[model samples]
Target: MTQSMEDFITDAFEQNYERIRLETGRAVTPNIKEAAREQVLLYYRRMRDVADGVTDTEVKLTLPEQRTPQQRKFTLEGVVDIVREGDRTTMYDVKTHLDADAAAGQLDQYVQQLNLYAHIWQGLRGEALDETAIIATRPTRELRQALRSGDDRVIDAAILKWRPCLNIPLDEHAVEDTVQRFGTVVDRIEERHFMPPAVEKLKAPIRPGARQPFGTAVCANCDVRFTCDSYRQFRLQTTPGMNPERVLQDAMNEYAASSEQGQWVDANMETLNRDRLPDAEDIDRGDV
Candidate 1:
């Protein structure tokens, strides 16, 4: 007896979902769970026939402490997957996105991170790395639309056309520079220097790599936005001009004259008017 692909996918999804729940104590809604299952199924379907040359997965690397005279000790660590084919080796860092090219502006940051990993691999571990790339698992909009439509033909067509891999260039020379910047950040943390950026800066993009204002893209998603003075100031600066007193008065008037209250009063008045009217039976018997 052979196991079908659908059955295999279902078993894999259940196992992974359970593991995630147990490890992280994270609960997802039904829609999110279904989407995750679809992603897994799509990945498997695409990679089923391709030779990945996967030698190792989830390979954790801890770089040695490069900064000296520090109050506290810290090490940079990262996880990556390695693919080896004969003498050539490739390192892959997996990322999830709706579009693979959505992070194009952040390429430099990725390069710096991957360069550090390359340094650790080549310089520290004496392992040769031929290439480094980001395997973005982006389930395309077409596939998602097809899934929503529940059309098998459309889904199959979309799945076959979907491509999610993005290759990143390896910059070995930037490794030392990236490491120095990391040391500076660690020093700031150890010194308890947690000063936030200015309000004007918060209104600007987080970095040259970002596409939108930091307030819109990053600060809006932050849980502590309401408590942050900079965020409050940014919101005030961006909000449309309005008379606070007039707005307050208008709100009060609206609450007082709400449609539901008006409806209730009208209904009561109608009942009272009906009660005061002459009875049809009395009029008919001439007994009014």
Candidate 2:
């Protein structure tokens, strides 16, 4: 329910790092807040190698004040974590996953998001980025051990575990495709159309072992599942005669994972270290 360390690092670091990053982008450089500056310092120390060739961090495609202009231009708004701008612009996004395979499966989404940044860059700079990269940071067992014990070893292991990937960069065709894809979704929303990506529930006992049904990966974090009629119907008809107690247990599990905003959600914003990553080399990719 809470934000992961990965998310926290991204956000907190951005808030601090952007002072210098944006200043370098603009003419008049301003001082960043103290709290934010500390985060930036910690990040550079922990992940020093990534600091190389890093022209900028926390670059935003659409500023809050620029929204009207951006929407008027029918643009996609996004943030690019790192940018190496020169004869050719290179973009990078930071990702955190359990492993390389888990990070690999999310390629399409990352590519599309990066493409939005490319479009924004081209609109402002008159040229598109040449390529994009993903910097996936996955904690290993030893790092987990270091984390649990708050040992200094975590600082070094974290740097060694980072995985860099060169992915398909945004081109003319990709930008056009992105525009069309977003357009289709916008049009559907305007038309009030609906397409529930239905998932098939299994006829198993109420094990409730954090195993999300296939095709319902989105549901695992969705708050509406608590009230979704479709989910309810599927659960009732296909739970293999699970009793009321079992059903209650399933709901409790959903509550634990739900990201929907509420008071409880606000209070649970601390990251869960134990749920960071499974230790087993061949562990099934459950929502754990």
Candidate 3:
């Protein structure tokens, strides 16, 4: 039997609520929860009707060290939201509940995930995917029927309105490079250089209004800030509402070769030496 939209929405929303809470270390209120529910419902509506492709569905890839023979180090996995079956298979990561302003920023780690998916597909099954896409939606009351008129026609139609930015493309060469970089990261980890790297790893920068308005620095949404040595050092070295220029500049440079929408810049911005960890550690909290 097919489940009603309400049932699926409840299940998806609850799952999202729990996953976000665990990842970000905060509580979500009823209003936020309801907004999330609406997003899930909206996603289903599009998959049911609007997409031009045939039979789009979510996917997951398991990559062992063997897949990256050059690296020969670690295994990893990624879950992709849309893999459309057709003359040429394409991958897309679906984003929901974001406004026009925030939709692009919300695509954190999508490039990495999608790249790995493409790389592994070529090795295990066949050639790389023909294309990659990110589908982000801003919901409105009349979105489902808006597709009928098309051509950004929904822009002027409704109250608390919604619009979608679809078919945002990913580059083939960039995806290949990203997959190669993933292997390099795993290769480094496997090296086991007798300690952590010289650089300090940082957390992601979150959505300004939606997830972490208070965050101005890279550690803004870090759940273990009080207990982590790296986070503590980040605080002492920087002030709130201020992002270090060096970090920002480096991120910009890295994304220079990529598209405006897909080149996401978040944390992992700055690096602190391993020698400095002792100074940043809190002995009371055992954050050494």
Name the top lDDT candidate.
Answer: 1
lDDT tens digits by residue: candidate 2, 137-185: 5443444455567656765565455444447556555765666677676
Q: Taking the tens digit of each residue's C-alpha lDDT, what string does model 1 give over 92-139?
A: 787655344444535677789888888888888899999887765657
State in Å the error of residue 276, model 3: 47
| Tens-digit per-residue lDDT, 1-288, candidate 3 | 125756866886788766765565445444445656765655555444435353445566777654343646556776655445656666666655444434445454556566667666666757557776665665633554564466454633531254454444454465556656777766665775323211133333345454422222333434444444454444445444555665444433432334422222211111123223555346767877
What C-alpha lDDT does candidate 2 achieve relative to the native structure? Answer: 0.53
lDDT of 2 at 59: 77
* Candidate 2: residue 37 Cα off by (Å): 14
Residue 14's C-alpha lDDT in candidate 2?
Answer: 59
Clashes of 1: 0
Question: What are the per-model numbers of colliding residue pairs?
Answer: 0, 0, 0
TM-score of each: 0.65, 0.53, 0.46
List ranges where model 3 is wrong by over 4 Å. Answer: 1-32, 45-56, 66-72, 82-88, 95-109, 137-170, 183-219, 226-288
The 10-residue segment of model 1 with minimum total lDDT is 247-256
Top-TM-score candidate index: 1
TM-score of 2: 0.53
Model 2 ranges off by over 4 Å: 1-47, 51-53, 62-74, 85-88, 95-103, 136-159, 162-166, 200-217, 229-241, 257-288
Clashing residue pairs in candidate 2, if any?
Answer: none
